[model samples]
Target: MREIAVVFVLLAFLAHSAMGEEMVFFADDLYKAAATPELHASLVDPAVAPGGSTALKIVVANSGRVLALLPTGIQGSSLEASREMQEELRSVDALNVVATLTAKDPVSVLSGPATIPLLPSGTAQPVEFLVQVGEGAEGPYHLDLRLDYEHQIDVRISAGQASPLYVPANVSEEITIHAGGSRESFRADYARSELWPGENGTLTLVIRNLAGPAGNCSARLLAAPPFRASDQPVSLGYMQPGDLALATFWVEVGDNASVRQYQMACQVLQDGESSAWSSTIPLTVAVEEGQSIQIWLVPLPLILALAFLAWRWWQG
Candidate 1:
């Protein structure tokens, strides 16, 4: 009888200890709620070009609270469900949460100060990360957001025995970004490749705004030695995305221009700055010697008169 009582006591203590330990599990709905249409991450601006800075907003709402303690084997007795139950609800400091952003393609983070600093319980915090897309970027990209945090639970065993337990919290979320605008909308190319020395010809250029927002824009040509721009600047008032514009300049080929190809520059001007918004492209100019001309036709009346005069002289 004595041995059986000792065995029961040992079992009860084992059961109690198991119930006293705290176990932290993330709510299954945590990530799902964030992925919802209303809470999903989004870009502040719909349009962004490579090397341009844009904002990526990440919203995280933690509904996860300490789970209730399980009942112990002893009748009319309960083990503290969890350490958190010993203390009332506490706010999770934003400083405890650490967030990192990554993508399949490399991106530069420009958001100042910090990312996802103070996240309170039962409330959503929208964190914005200013970032610049890398070169060679195209439409449709996925960014990986990793959040690491610590949940501190107050454990009180007795007077002067209060201690805090730290639970590591880690969560990963993937957000989609639709990157647009390839380089600039405007394109520059030479209309004609060949030029003749000492001749006035049209330097035809075709400019097109491909796949971008509409705005007021202007264009200009920059020429080097042996190539001169007849028109310094041309007005391209309002151009919509994918709009095409044409500009022609009458250029005189220098008499000293060599037969080799010379490069001319053309670009789209920015609204306020002297720099060009679009990339500068080389316009190839090839100078060739003028072709020789020969007269093949004479006046019919003069030829007939000369023939008659010759006949009269021969007859005399």
Candidate 2:
């Protein structure tokens, strides 16, 4: 009985060792099954101008190689092994992919996150995002592209086995775009800066083209409350770089306008494109109170009339 008990203890120890070895082998197989999908992205058009709206085209692809090995120590038929291997290869495909783009100040992403239902291995898909650049933006800017998706890692083909492991992947990439430097296209100055309430006057704006040449350039007054432009847009004709021109508008001030400095703007249009205004130049003007009649002057007129009547009566 003692010998039998000792033999039983030895058998149990060997069984434990065998189980440990199997686990180690299974862990190694899982490591071998681990694969990462390769993705590359870039902007379709890398050059952009400040104060402009554009689209960013991102192309995503999966270039991961499929694994050709089965889990270790599994005694399955060739057909079963083939099926499992196929499933493992399919795991290289990215599923439920989501992409997000982020930008810093002066650059804004107008569109929301882009989505992809499936990205099969060795396949590429294109996604677009609308971007708006501020007027002050200049030089090269870096935009962040983030990709999130689920990818299958391993498949279990036994009863009560856990479902295929779908691992979440996060990829961060940087995209560079060159933005043209911003320059003052035009400078504006007012010819007359003061007007009285209930007054009609001609307002002149001296516009100097500081940047590029423009043709059919015109300027219109953006008169708000308390001011109105009676004339249409005034033409400045063709202007070369560094050229100066004048635009005049017949303006009427409201009677109830306040006696203070009022802010105004001038809209400059080029090439008869009324829908697209090149720039808005800010302006400032002051409204003064009208002069009142003096009390002495009013009495002098009445005294003169009375004096003339007395002289006529005495002469009669």
Candidate 3:
């Protein structure tokens, strides 16, 4: 009978020990599963003008919070447990964050990636990036936003406790923005579209105001190799919407210019405004080969008159 009782007592002790171990393991698993981070991102200003540079503002926020209680079987006093709970709650904070902005085609990110040392829970941070919209870009465009960071996932407060565990995380988002507005427009017309090598001619540029009214508007020609311009900038004084103005430039073709079409650019600007507008008007002109017979024919009339006079004298 004594031996049976001792055996029964030993079995009960073993069962209690096993139950405590199981509870401790369950508590650790609960802590790891409850602490998680959630991040949200949005653009502050969503409208931008084409052919211009603007600052893109983005706001990043942390919405994660502690919603579960600490499980039982973890050994700690009431005060100690409160401290541990607070530390666990901070596990949702994002650390060492980096945000990169990207776009396709007509939109370009001019600034580098933004970095944040730490972002606390229930808080937000604003980041600004300089971006450029292409000259031909219009309508709506999408920009890619990526965020990389690390956050605490688990914390150990009992025996054999070490540092908190941090895991790497990433988030991807898209920002949409409208990129179009009223801007200056121009068109070019050449008075002499065709020219001969070593020839001088005139080029006429017709300017039409498609945007708002402007004062002291002027236009200039930008000539490249094989083409030379001797005219200065022409003033249009004041221009209203849908108004048309003409600018003429004296162009000289190089002697050894190739017999092909060449492209040139025209620049337009406003006099008293801090904002300067530019448009690429690809004005093309063809250079043709000069005929030797046509050159000789120019002096044929004078030569014929002199020969006729001399022949009459000789005949007399």
Candidate 4:
């Protein structure tokens, strides 16, 4: 009986060891490194501008036994012509802000100090960051991002602290890239405010009409870290003389929604008839759990009737 008990215990230990074996993970990254051309050359880049906000983004993948940690830091930067535009870029609310992790796959990601977390044992999750450039120094300036990471150790780790990266880190620094500076006029208009959750919240627009018809238009939503369209042409449709046709479409936010205001837009047709739109109407989502929120526009139908009555009395 004693010998049998010892044999059972040994088998249980072996089974647990087998289950704890580490699994290898892998992912491929197609990256573009930034470079500088001769100062005299003109390159067209719609990303960097003087007075507007252009986003800088990069993707990262990790495979390890524990969550990956990329430290807080800057990666790279490009120059922009036009001092006026530069001032606007630098002056925006989040301008000159330090780098922090903005997004991650498997979703529900947020910023953290020191290091950002990466997934383990799977090549499917990709991490992304949104760097907002508010008012920043003139072009020809070097921007830096500190890359740091942490991982869980087999031993105990203290609260609010982390172990060093378990996997090797390979982030490309300065590859090779150039930039351009050309002014393109832009305009965006809203239809009204108020939208339904998981429904299409639409907007209209008129851009570069006076600047010579319209060019490329786009739609953007600033929920938090800033999420804009990645593969969409949020542009306007066609129109007839004196007839303002549609310009942009709304994002279907699906069934899950919360109380929030959204901005929206559309654009005039010309030069690609491009369009720009806000993510939401200024209207609140007015959603509640286990209940429905209804929002309707209250129109004053009697205003026109009262105006006609007053006109008749004045004529008499």
Clashes of each: 4, 0, 0, 39
TM-score, ranked from best to worst:
3, 2, 1, 4
lDDT of each: 0.47, 0.60, 0.60, 0.28
Q: lDDT tens digits, residues 18-49, model 2?
A: 43311112231221233445555544445455
As for model 3, its CA RMSD to the true structure in angstroms is: 35.5
Residue pair clashes in candidate 1: 69-81, 94-117, 94-118, 94-119
What is the clash tally of candidate 2? 0
Model 1 lDDT tens row, 20-126: 43333222101000000011122222234566777765555554332222222223212333332333133132236667777655566665433555554444565
lDDT assessment of candidate 3: 0.60
What TM-score, to 2 decimals, does candidate 3 have? 0.47
Name model 4 segments beyond 4 Å from true. Answer: 1-184, 204-208, 214-245, 263-284, 288-316
TM values, all candidates: 0.37, 0.46, 0.47, 0.28
Write down the RMSD of candidate 4 (Cα, Å). Answer: 26.5
Q: Which is the winner by lDDT between candidate 1 and candidate 3?
A: 3
Worst 10 residues of 2 by lDDT: 22-31
Which candidate tops lDDT?
Answer: 3
